[model samples]
Target chain A: MIGAVPARDATLAERLRAGRSPRRRAVDRAGRGLALAATLACVVPLAAVLFFVVAKGAGALNLDLLTKPAKALGTGGGALQSWLGTVQMVGLATLIAVPVGIAAGIYVSEFAGHRAARAIRFASDVMVGVPSILVGIFVYVLLVLPFRQFNAFAGSVALAVIIVPVIQRTTEEVLGLVPRELREGSLALGVPSWRTTLSVVLPTARAGVLTGVMLGVARAAGETAPLLFTALGSRLVNIGGFGEPMDSLTLFIYNGARSPIAALNDQAWGAALLLLLLVLGINVSVRLRSMGGVRA
Target chain B: MREDPVEMSVAAPVAAPPEPQREALPTAPSTVPGGAPLSLAPPAAGIPGAAPATVPAAKIEIRDLNLYYGPFRAVRDVSMGIAANQITAIIGPSGCGKSTFLRSINRMHELTRHASMDGQVLLDGVDVYSPEVDAVDLRRFVGMVFQRPNPFPTMSIYDNVVAGLRLGGGARKADLDEVVERCLRAAGLWDEVKDKLRAGGTSLSGGQQQRLCIARALAVDPEVILMDEPASALDPVATLRIEELMLELRGRFTIVIVTHNMQQASRVSDFTAFFSMGEDRAGYLVEMDRTARIFTNPREKLTEDYVSGRFG
Candidate 1:
């Protein structure tokens, strides 16, 4: 406006000409079909899995299935031990993983020099790629044999090792999303670096960090291979004290799903449903909190 | 790009939230100073410039300063003396290092990796670049407002204003209320926001948010306030309001502003420094003079070209 130039005539490209050519419409149709195929390719499998799982497990659930312990190798039993054991180990692992993981994330994102932080982040990404079974074995040898017994604690240690890198990497990435302006605003107030990170950076990224934490917890909860060598499933509802063998839904499903017994098969379906629900619950809660934060 | 703060329509329903009041801001929160948290309606004696001991001297002196980002030298040896309780405007085209020079006052440029500098920034004749002078404490005496309005998205309006005090710690509620009102009043934002102090800082309009950022800076009672294109994102009306607030703030805080608008520099500043980058693209000051002289009759040909809109 200040320069005072006259408006030019509209170019052909700008005069509502998009999607008018026959070739354009054909390309558009192709793109739509391909995208639909891709979407269905993913959604079909997921929907089938949900349907099959529900169909198989729906009739299997009763109060007994949840409240009673497995008897005679998961035949005519409720899977109570597996439920309790899954809760304990996942809960324990989350307790151990969350603090250390978040701290490492903060250090990598905020404090470490570029090269050093990159090295750590690279290691974390590689750690994520490491086979879960190998993590189980590493913990099995380091924790299990040294403690001279199988125990829930050993399983927790293994799960926590697997969870740490995921949460740490996620936290670093999520914290990175917090704009530099907020960090500068805090620091420019004469607030110390540490205080700035805690009060401003962390709080600003609260919803995202919670997503990372929940993802780690959900991952640790359902893992079968990691607990296989460490937890060593039990039939009774033991608290699975530090050195005691424990039970988990994944352990139950792995062994039961392969068996010929009809009752054990049904129990496996129920266990799968339960684990799926738990993960779903965690994901839904994360979404709700994120939405609430935005709305507020 | 400049915007004109479009005044809201005069005809409004009864339930609408309070708009910016044109008349005088609500009186002193209508309560005693340092008393309760203004229950019904709705105060900076400790401010650095208030003392005669600290007045009438150069507040900040930048000497032989060079700033670098890794191997690229962005700013070359530039020197300037800023008088206390006066507004100095820094004007330049884009990428001219005016913003970089402003950031050096509070040592904010050092926050980025590989950003290094060689300079002496003296506050009250004490070198801020010396190892013993903590950057954190130095910022309290010299505050900054950014080009874009960046109120913390998570914090409420009142929280954003008092954030500096809370970070310093040991502040009572009564003290916080007083600072909030005083700072908001100084920024010319008290009347629009006092009722919705608990609302998110981001809920305010763009112009109001910029003013909120100003209030946040003023709450620290900074000896010097550095603003980097503070009105660049606002409407013309909002820009004018900020300009008026700058004049009102004269004598309470030594102000240094970086702006691209030559008219704004001529209108508001007591002294004007013109900066431009040369062949190597490293910005350096071309001229520094009283505002009237710089705008009407500058000694440097480059300054004349920039001011007369012949060249940038």
Candidate 2:
């Protein structure tokens, strides 16, 4: 019987080792080629945008472009005022939104019942897809009209509305990635539910969740439509507190892009380059940090 | 812990019914309102609540336990005594609910949605499921080690050992240091890990990580330790080490282990309880006795068949 088994197995092995037919080989090659094409389809556009911005914007770059405020009528000055407004407003927006978004995310992932979680998740998904112009209009009606002035605080609130959904959704997804085993292990140690969620679950998911927060900040920094009806853009540096009008990089690019003056147009390209680099820098660093760190 | 994946159920022939014990256990299903009719399998022979006078005082006594997940009964009419400061091994075929029965002792099964139980699990004669008894406090006394080695991924080795005490309240740094060393030594891991207390808990190898989890369990100073197939995921060498540790810990804590490995059960346990699934697919205990008696001369034919490697 053993000899018969070897004889049968030899035939099976011979059949399995038979080379792929010409048609199958051709199909496999075509599939590989198609996948490569799809990948290049994504990369080519991104590479072109980066190349064009650097090529056009690098010539316009100078210390004066970043450090000095824009000229009164001409384009002989920089976007110090614009960039500062962006920093303050986005920072303020982060302060307002991070706590609320993270708290809701934790509640949905760790405590809510199935129906409640689903409802909140659905609401956030819808909010993520809502138009930024609509958010600007809503803030216009809610804060700008009521206060009778366009203020940096109103702009921060508008950006915050856009940011909350991104942070909430990403926080929920990242927390979900933490293994159920970790929670069980903590609970089995006789730790109460709240302590388990706070000390163990949150720390385990910290890096991934922070990456989400950074992405949200990047998204908020580049928004112009929401600030159009809120901050309303200022030409001269308005050092007046958050209650006054503000100018941001996005607002600077928007106004500069529309100017008839050639210098102003060139400065628009420089501002665009700076905005792109900032967003790209944040995304790259976060990706690298999450990829290289040992999760344990 | 949401409904463990069902193991393939082997069709076990129906054995003759056991003689019913006195004191018909009242069924008080915790989750199901208007207590569901208890259609459980016939109760088995080991009722330590009414055992012969010579049995040692039971550290944990289970009385007519039936566990359910949603509507399906998983463990049926399990009543046995785990002797004080001794090791009791629960051995069974896959899908016979050995793990479920073990979890019920510490109320760990209640973590699963729709999980409920009927009857009593007494810890030192106090009904652990009583309303006034906090489940979290109960867990502090009855610690568990899981099948997989799950050390907190973000904590340092030292932090993982002191997690329970630190969470409960303040512990002096000196006390924490002392507990860490004592528990790690008890778990046979101090020599391997003493120099790297600040290293991430998950930096250790799989066997060492399992020992870390054991040391974490030991640090809480639990009166009873429940190990649910704690060494099954490990290699032969690691498995032997865990067995040796259990033997070393035998008299200090009442240890209850659920294992699929019958050799492991015989090697480390003082008493052995054999479980088998009835025709309805709810697991019930067949017999419980001294390990030597269960292996050499069993009261039930099923236990003999299982221990002799004739069948599971």
Candidate 3:
């Protein structure tokens, strides 16, 4: 009689310890699978684009493509002229934009209540959303057409127009990130307000500002739409200012890719590859600089 | 268990010994016809019902003071005087305008664009809020330390201590070095930080940073020092050090401190003002008296309740 009762109790315990409901188990498995699928979906496109660019462009990248000038007439040569033009124009644009952009950003972030600052911020936001081609047209009318010619200056102005809003917006956002206690501490020292901003607040946000400026440069460097109307195009290497037409890699690619000759097409690919590498190198440097700032 | 009779006599008074009846009170030096007495003594009883004028003739006096932030009134119709070379602690719970009262003394609240005040703040018998008196100069006379120790994070300890002196501008190298040494010593931090003068102020421990801030305030040689919860962020040992420093500071500079710690008020202050909330949550000073009497035998029920930890 005792053995029969113990056996019955054991059977009841086994029934109570049964596995999870089938529907709940299926739902948990499906949730895990769905999360995995979502993550893969987001990553796949980025990996594919990186793979395609490296695979298609790596063979054409060499020192010659970087050091020599573009092809003559319909023949293959190099991208030195286009490369130089890109550098000069972007360099000039940066020189013009960084100071004005950063100042405007500081004004907006530091004096948010002022009417003029509000207007400037609004205009910057509007400008950022405007198409690059519109900026090119605006510059063509306001600058290039007035001179009756396209030149490196016109190209730079167009690029500056595009870059200014980006730098201003990013700088304002970064400056806003600096804690108010830092500013207040300096002010409490009887330090004049402007000096406090320059000496204490700006140094704290320097890395973020630099990263923003570099990102602006990267964005403006590859802009084919703006340069199409501003710099026009040229096969020969020229170093003149606003008076003469200039060469750029984007224009070189656009013009060369249309050529019937196979050699010209190959040179165009090399120029494209060079542009990519330059931007990539800059991005890597910016990342390293940001990491260094974090550690510091 | 043997207390001296002299100590008992000195400790017995709930209020200052009634100013030797008017006839015996010393008159001011007659250098200037209408100049007030240099001594910080309570006013004689010429006017009736003036609440016995507990506060002495002012190192600092705020008269009919009203503070506003846009539409909201923070402190209203408040008047008080801080005595020379005494420690006055303003104790109340959070948002009772204790910190506000402290900041108003140095005009530190004026840095806020929306903050405005209507009243007279007299420092050394001169109206600090007068149009001719610069806020910067006012701050030099009445330096302040905040609730949190903020020692200019980017600056070295030496620079942090000397910042106000440098801002005062144009002192010779010997004078500056002397002042830095004197102020750091007064702040009780010179011995610990003497070797690390070049290290960043932020590299110091929390208590050290607070002491550094005190040193920074001392560097300016202000006649009055305002501290708002200066020791609240520190550990007990650090807090004791700061309290001891306050006592040391009291011999030289008049100090006004705002604290939530009732025990701190009793331990470090010569006078304590008990502030409490009213119908609209507006804070008003319930009583100001000798610290010993305020703790042991407060006159006001609210003051008694707060000190006894019955309610805040």
Best by DockQ: 2
| B196-272: candidate 1 lDDT, tens digit per residue | 98899999998999999989887766668899999999999999999988877765567899998989988888778
Colliding pairs, model 1: B3-B235, B3-B236, B4-B235, B4-B236, B5-B235, B5-B236, B5-B237, B28-B42, B29-B42, B30-B42
Instruction: For candidate 2, write residues B1-312 as lDDT tens digits.
Output: 011111101111122111122112333222112323232223322453333422244667888899999999999998877766668999999999999999898888999889999998888668999998988888888989999999998888999898887875534565678778888887889999999998989999888999999999877777789999999999999999999888777656778999999999999987788999999999998888777778898878788888888887
* Candidate structures ordered by lDDT, highest first: 2, 1, 3
Per-residue alpha-carbon lDDT of candidate 3 for residues B84-115, written as tens digits (9 for 90 to 100): 66788999878777877777887777877698
For each prediction, how big is the interface RMSD? 2.0, 1.9, 3.5
lDDT of 1 at A23: 62
Alpha carbon deviation, residue B60, candidate 2 (Å): 1.0
Poorest stretch of ten by lDDT in candidate 1 chain A: A1-10
Clashing pairs in 3: none
Segments in model 3 whose C-alpha atoms lie over 4 Å from true places: A1-38, A114-120, A240-242, A257-261, A283-296, B1-51, B163-185, B191-198
Error of 1 at B205 (Å): 1.0
Enumerate the candidates' DockQ scores in order: 0.39, 0.50, 0.19
The model with the greatest TM-score is 2
Between prediction 1 and prediction 2, the one with superior lDDT is 2
TM-score of chain B of each: 0.81, 0.83, 0.83
